[model samples]
Target chain A: MPGEHPQTLTRSTVAVRSASAPAAPDAETLHEIHRQERASVTGAPVTAPLLPAERALLRSVEHAVLDERRLLTATELSALAALPDSAVMALASLAHQVRLTWCGPAVEVEGILSAKTGGCPEDCHFCSQSSRFDTTVKATPFLDTDEVLEAARQTAALGASEFCIVLAIRGPDERTLARILELVPLVHAETGLNVAVSAGILTKDQARRLAEGGVHRYNHNLETARSFFSEVVTTHSFQERVDTCQLVREEGMELCCGALLGMGESDEQRIELLSELQDLDPTEVPVNFLNPRPGTPLGDRAPVGAWEAVRWIALFRLALPGVILRYAGGREITLRDLQAIGMTAGINALIVGNYLTTLGRSSADDLQMLDDLRMPVAALTVAF
Target chain B: MTQLPAADSAPAFCTGCGQSSASCPGCGRDFDPPRYCSACGRWMGVTVTPSGWTARCKEHGEQHSA
Candidate 1:
């Protein structure tokens, strides 16, 4: 029995298409990762926690995700989503456990710069950059190379391993692409940090060029579910954004695809979006809440409730156990003092400094939160 | 003073320090940058970056979020 080989293992053209098979994990991946045990990051699970009326439903989810490490189906996720406020903390506890088991304790710190602010041609209802909306943001040309380099330097100083250069455009044109191509290597060379680009949609050639030129990841958000997309943006179809993400993956770069919540989409829609995100197979998912930019169509929308934020953060983690689930953009307004709750709720990464247009809480405060939680940040390059 | 082009031209009761009422406790506790100068009821032109924010009140000069 010990000497027998599987018949399926003899196939010539196996599932893996790589010219070479993947190498086994080194010490860093095997030993250094998952450094903590027993989900010590979050304190003791809730005492006599209020659970869903259907306790078995929660039990089944825990069994599938925790025991088997399988993704949750939309049906499983929605049942948890509809659970009363009483059962949320328990759900969060399970989500936190899934995160600890799957992702480990190392938190990825990143800083984002709005390289080209405002003046977008598209009409995204929740965006301040859209020219269709009479917003406070003014159209500005791209930042100079020096400015971009300085921002990257500052980002590096924060001990950030990743820096994203974001532009407020529908898609980067040839001229814009040239500037980005020049900057990606310069930023990486200078800061020793991976650079991600979020210059709207990308053509196949552009994605390949960026991939070949050393761009680490591409940021393109599906924003909402396909069914609810037309309500949020009139200019671009959700499929186009999906195609761009597909191209990024085809060209061999990590996809930093994300979603924006609280745009009045139904719970069913949110689950639908989660399932869709699973299908896309992103390495990172930046969970953004609608902060409701003024003058934009959705300016008056209310901020997502803090508890609701925590609940979804957990759901996203459970839904995509292997993703670098990040707390992005709206956490400042959405979670406020309860921000640290997200760390335990399955967020292994966050944008520490100011968001693109809105002001974020101090970097010192965020660093302190990580310190208090005893969570190890990946880099310790510079002290604030 | 140029009004904050923010959709809601009128600042909320929680806009800044003096504007706080019993109903809205203001941002001193919550720590949001002031969008309007409480002294003159003027919208503060705000530029927010990772470092912090600078809200410029036409008459009151500038307020930095240290």
Candidate 2:
């Protein structure tokens, strides 16, 4: 017996049998022997075998993803979400593998310019710009065309593939909308950057106009699950947001819709939100953690734990295997040191540089992180 | 007393230098207001109250207390 390690030999020893010895050990018999040996060494019971239901779920996931290479249904996704904590690492590994298969090693970088700030009439409890909240954010007039163009130039200079003009409003007034429509072509013509806009809820006509004006994507976050939305924003119904997203799709513009995690929502609600996103089939899903600006209603809520954030990102990737998953605001505060792990968990895009109302880590630092991970920043392309 | 123009109109000129005024006294460039921090040149998200102005910077919180 080449006893390099007694634990290592336990399995092969059982596999060998003479005619005089007992009949061939079954798979279960070998498993039990290994489990007993592990117990002996660790002085604790090994984890029990997967229950029938859990095994069925895992088999389904493997069959759907590995064998068939088809997207999992919402039911299958929920089953994955319902996996126990002990199985979370497996889930993350599957999600990371799925991300690599679909998105490869390219990390798309985008930047946002807060073109219009504060004085929003809506009452999103997490937003600092809401007029209903007494947060430190101050009202600023819509930036002039030159100012917006300068910001776009800076965005390009930072090597971001996309530049978004974000306005704080329930919806854009006619003048504000007209100004954005005019600026879109200028930005595209001048900077050679993909232009995106987040001008709050949109009418069908406005959506059509934006599509005609060279706007590539329209962003309007659902912000949370339908069941939990009312607790976060009372002024607007969730249906209206859904309607606007549908309108954006009808107008042939790519929809960039997502929700904020850690807003006092239950795990079921988080999975539900992902289900809704899967239904929406948005071109991009920007996952924002609740940063909880001081003076907002949710300011007192704690930041999401790093590992929990990773699990959330993993779940998002598993839920929407093909969509561009972006690391948006609150990443710096929530993930902190483990930001790179968040990328591995299923994030293929980043909101580089500053966010709308808060600052982000420097674009250089984000680029360096991508370099360290040996992931290239994606060039501007319509496929995303 | 001079009556201010409509809120949408061009901002008033600087009294000190006779040029168009920006919100930040230090930079004097036309930028969207509430302007950047005068001390550190970082963007300051300012809140105006009856007592005075309070500007918050991301790197340095509450840079200006008026």
Candidate 3:
């Protein structure tokens, strides 16, 4: 009698299993699954050639343009661009329009002064300047105020809208900071260039001082997404970077934060970084494609492909909507032919010629790139 | 930092301020630097404190030594 019942149950189980069997999905069904997966992973939803719902969102976000509605949370944004080539292009185009709204047509230029070069105590794996790495970059003490001022002058003369004063330490000492205060005012008086600084870790007091010193912007990069940060730098926690950015914002300085791509982070991580940036809504976001400097942990990592750069930049435009998107660092070394394409792909600002310790394309070349692209050059004027 | 883990050295002096009780030179208000300076502080050089230094003030800029 028990066996009889078991046989009945077994027969039912067999029927259920048959019904739930993994069928050979038709090409269309397979494509649908692929689309769902891509959307989930990239945050850009896929649609048949075009869909009214997606199109409407893209249209509303930028009436004159066509940037898609960027997801605010990581979970939602993690699924854009789940489609193949054509869908990707459409979404990217929408992103381009979004970039146009905030950044305008011009690619703003800036210069970087590695004020205190090399010997960083923290071991950020992507950086060659860290003390832990054996990169041959000369570990010089902080530069003189006058020298820093002169560099600002040179950048301003070349028509750069801003000059970044960067240091390569955990943070600056009091003596170095005092020099910055003096130089900041002097440089402002001398060149009238918008001065920005990136001196490692920042405290609330230091953020206020930088703001008071007429430092226009303070940059503290998230480097990567929260989920992906530990894989990049173990010495400093990701929360520390967030705290510094908050302090910078609290001090009323324009926060310029962004991430480095191609450091072996997943696509989901890239979206997560964007979502995080969206919440902060920084004034300026500098997107750095990893050049993978020699001697750094990521030295062997290859540069992110050109399309990926465009996709990310365009995505940034959509996500940020109204922040300065500066195509920084490895633009030349990474995106060779598509340099000008970035201007159209939602990159409104660029660091013109020479990076901290790395040689970038010259200012003249950048100007020509802008001219060739037919993009206008507008001065980056923020209330701060 | 302690010379050899004496466990009781009169807390190390700031290389920048040089005073046994050197307040942040920039702000000159906070008693002992929170990390660096309290105000107008810039990135001074990194100091390896025995107990780790307080995070430096975000605003302190480096003073150019003449």
Cα lDDT tens digits, model 3, A109-167, are 88887778777888999997888986645366677776677677768876788888888
Write down the RMSD of all candidates, one decimal each: 12.2, 10.6, 17.4
Q: Model 3 - which docking category? A: incorrect
User: Each candidate's chain B TM-score?
Assistant: 0.54, 0.41, 0.19
The regions of model 1 sitting more than 4 angstroms off are A1-48, A51-53, A379-384, B1-48, B53-66
Candidates, ranked, DockQ: 1, 2, 3
DockQ each = 0.29, 0.06, 0.02
* Better candidate by lDDT, 1 or 2: 1
Q: Quick one: best DockQ, which candidate?
A: 1
Winner on DockQ between 1 and 3 is 1
lDDT of 2 by residue, A1-384 (tens): 442333434444445322233333333443344344444344221233333334435545655665566766665665566555444555666777878877777888887888888989999999988989876576877877886787788788878878899999898779988999999999999999899999988888999999999899899898889999999999989999999999999999989998799889988788788878878988889999988776799989998877678878888987777788899989988888889887787888998876775667767788899999988888533222
Model 3 spans > 4 angstroms off: A1-76, A381-384, B1-66
Return whichever of 1 and 3 wins on TM-score.
1
Strongest candidate by lDDT: 1
